[model samples]
Target: MRRLILLRHAKSDRPLGIVDLDRPLNDRGKRAAPQMGAYLAAEGLIPEAVVVSPAKRTRETWEAIQSALTGPEAEVVPSIYEAPEAALLSIVQTTPDTAGSLLMIGHNPGLQDLAMRLAGSGEKAGRKRLSLEFPTAAVVVLDFEGDAWSTVAAGTGRLERFVAPRDIKIGD
Candidate 1:
């Protein structure tokens, strides 16, 4: 089984005069990112490989999460910046065969759309919540039955879990 983890970048700062790709995460995002990372560690969801968008916000999100996960080095993929669901899938399909699990840090509606399109079933409540909205800092874990990433396709992954910062109550 192959596992795919999709994490939408945390809430980003909307500073005037700054391009979207260069925007960093806001205070809340800074807080939430690590918490989500710790949650992933707690659940043993470490990835064998990671692909992240090069946007500042997404890159910052990865940096924040690294404190909690010892996953492999992340590859910055420019195409992931504003890619749609299909494009995201193409990236997934291209993941190296050596990786048993992969993590992607990116933006949405692409991340949300990809999660919805690939996940056909699993936990009912989580699926329902995911369909509603894939908010900032939200992470969806999907399990694909295929032996290789190339064989995984739309409507074939099972939603193993869907979590967000709100679901975690960590004290400052």
Candidate 2:
């Protein structure tokens, strides 16, 4: 089985004069990003590679979580910045088969849609939650039955877990 972690970039500060792609994370987002990473680490869901968007906020979010990630493999892909769901899907499909797990840190709408499309029947509640909106610092874990990322398809993966910043803090 291959695991895919869909992570939405943490809350970003509104760009006053800052360009949309250059806006950094707000304080809350900064705090939440690492917490989410720690939670994932504690739960033993480590990814072999972390694929991230090159936007400022996404890069900062990844930096916040860097400490919690066990391995040293991470790639900042410019294509992920403002990418549509199709682009995101393409990136996932092209990932090497040897990598058992992947973590994609990117933006909303696309990420949310991808999660809903891949989720299994048992995760109806989580799917419903995702259908609303993907909040900042949210992580959804999906388990694809096939060994290769290219074989992933709609409804073929089960939603193993879903964690949002608020839920993590409440559990703490």
lDDT string, candidate 1, 53-109, tens digits: 999999999999997998798999999999999999999999998999999999999
lDDT of 2 by residue, 1-172 (tens): 9999999999999967899899999999999999998988888888998899988899899889889879656799999888887888889889999889999999988898788877865467887888887899999998888789999887888888788988875255
TM-score of each: 0.97, 0.95
Residue 73, model 1: Cα distance from true site in angstroms: 0.9
Candidate-wise lDDT, in order: 0.93, 0.87
Give the Cα error of residue 111 in candidate 1, in Å.
Answer: 0.6
Q: Which parts of model 2 are misplaced by more than 4 Å? A: 170-172
Q: Which has the greatest TM-score?
A: 1
Model 2, residue 22: what's the lDDT? 94
**Root-mean-square deviation of candidate 1:** 1.3
Question: Could you tell me how far off, in angstroms, the CA of residue 63 lies in candidate 1 after the best superposition?
Answer: 0.4
